[model samples]
Target: MNMQIENNFSYHAPKPGQPEIYTAIREKAKELAYLIDEKAPNSREKSLAMTKLEEAVMWANAAVARN
Candidate 1:
């Protein structure tokens, strides 16, 4: 039997100016993309979720750029 376990990974942004923070964000985005792909009920919902995630990453990048 193939049992699929649901993941609840939380992304915590690391210290500013550290590479770890970027890595963390990238990993988090990938996880979110996977969850969105797997659990979204329909294409519209999936598109919305992906758009939101993209916006969030852009916002994070902007914040980092400002610092």
Candidate 2:
């Protein structure tokens, strides 16, 4: 595998303060999830919105982990 690609695929252990950053990201995502659950009507669109929010959170975490 290419070195850059290998590096990208590797698990990155959290450095000092990184776990705190990850926790903050997750907390904010949770707050948005609560608002979505309370305010959005029960429908397919709302379901999709929730799914996308989950994807956003995963991608955000990956960005922090990889960079």
Candidate 3:
């Protein structure tokens, strides 16, 4: 099997300092969510924006963990 594929598929435990990185990502996402709530009108577009934001956060965390 390819090493990169194996690593990407495997679970990665939080190493030192990773928790803080995750927290920062979450905090920033929360801030963006709040801004969206305050500024963007509630609609399907707004909902999709929120959903994409969530996906972005997940990918960011995965990047941190996988790298």
Model 1 Cα shift for residue 10 (angstroms) = 32
Q: For every model shown, what is its TM-score relative to the native structure? A: 0.62, 0.87, 0.94
Local accuracy by lDDT, each model: 0.69, 0.90, 0.98
lDDT, model 1: 0.69
Clashes of each: 0, 0, 0
In candidate 1, where is summed lDDT lowest over 10 consecutive residues? 1-10
lDDT of 1 by residue, 1-67 (tens): 3222222233435455656666677789989899888888877878988999988976775455434
lDDT of model 3 at position 66: 98
Query: Model 3, range 13-34, lDDT digits (tens) per residue?
Result: 9999999999999999999999
Evaluation by TM-score, superior candidate among 1 and 3: 3
- Tens-digit lDDT track for model 2 on 1-67? 6988987889899888888888998899999999999999999999999999999988898888888
How far in Å is the alpha carbon of 24 misplaced in model 2? Answer: 0.4
- Top TM-score hit: 3
Deviation of model 2 at 40, angstroms? 0.7
TM-score of 1: 0.62
Off by over 4 Å in 1: 1-19
